[model samples]
Structures are given as structure tokens and as C-alpha cells.
Target: MRNLQGWEIFVLLAVVVLLFGAKRLPDTARGLGRSLRIFKAETKGLREDDAKDATKDTTVTTAAAEPVVVEPRPIESGVAQAPAAGAHAVHRDAADR
Candidate 1:
């Protein structure tokens, strides 16, 4: 078991070569190569998918900034503050046009 002579290895090779002929060896190698390529491509695709999922779209908000609030005034207050309120009638041209 420790030391294997050259003749022993030659005998093993001869037996394997006979069991699987030389003509069929190339086909088997090609099939093995194609399988490995497909496996690598699938692994790469899964890695890209994982990366896309890792960098997501939802915004990340820190609690440091204070929120800004906007308030809407009543309709009567807006009409009273308007400069042209007395000069122009409300919705007068809209009905004529």
C-alpha cells in the first residue's frame, strides 16, 4: 500500500482503458465539461440575484432631522387676502368662456 511500482500503475491504466474505450473517452470528457460550465453559470446567476436583493430600494431615515409640517388656510381667508378679490368676480369668465 505504501509503495506502488510502475508496472502496477500500467496494469491499472490498461484495465481502465479497456473498460472505457478511447473513442468514447472524448464524449465523456465533453459532457463533464458542459456540466461544470452549467453549474458555474447557475452559481454566478444566484450570486448576482443575492447581490440585487442585498441592495434594496426602501429609504433609510436617520432619527437626527426634525420633521417639517405644512398647514393649509381656510378658503375664506385666502379670498380675503387676495389683491384682485374685489376687482375680479369669482368664476365670472369661466362661465362665459
Candidate 2:
């Protein structure tokens, strides 16, 4: 597509002025500018937050570079293991009698 010529730009501005009126045009433009500024600021903040998150992820990965090996601890005397199914039935019958 070809670029907009000066005449096209002028016509578009004239149409906008006619549609919105001269009085409301400045207020509309100001509101549009404010919206753009707020949008830019939010996007910039999001980019900064994303950068921080990226650094955090990198540091976390590097810090845990070596694979961690965790050995299971032996069961203590105070903690009892569950009995076998057959043993449970026998125990239940013995208790009932």
C-alpha cells in the first residue's frame, strides 16, 4: 500500500473535526494521550517484571545446578508400619473373640 499524502491527511483531520466538533476535539485528544501514557507505563512495568523473573529463574537454576540426592531415612520405633492383609484379618478375629 502507498503512504498517505498531505491532502489525505488534511481530509482525514477535517472529517474528524466535523464529527467530533472543535470544542470536544481537545478533550478527546487529551484523554487519548493520557490513555497512551498509561498503556506505555503498564507495558514498561510488565517488561521490567518479566526481566526480574527471568533473572530469578536463571539464579535458581544455577544455584541448583547439581542434582540433589536425598536418601530415605530409616523408620523410627515410634512409627509403626501397617500389617499385611492376612495378618490384619487374623488380628481382627483374635480381637473379636
What lDDT does each candidate get? 0.73, 0.76
* Candidate 1 accuracy as lDDT: 0.73
Candidate 2 backbone collisions, by pair: none
After TM-score superposition, the amount by which residue 11's alpha carbon in candidate 1 deviates from its true location, in angstroms, is 5.7
Tell me the TM-score of each prediction against the true structure. 0.45, 0.57
Best by TM-score: 2
Clashes of each: 0, 0
RMSD in angstroms, all models? Answer: 20.9, 16.7
The count of residue-pair clashes in candidate 2 stands at: 0
Candidate 1: residue 31 lDDT (0-100): 97
TM-score of 2: 0.57
Candidate 1 local lDDT, 18-63, one digit each (tens) = 9889888789889999999999999999999999988987687755
Off by over 4 Å in 2: 57-97
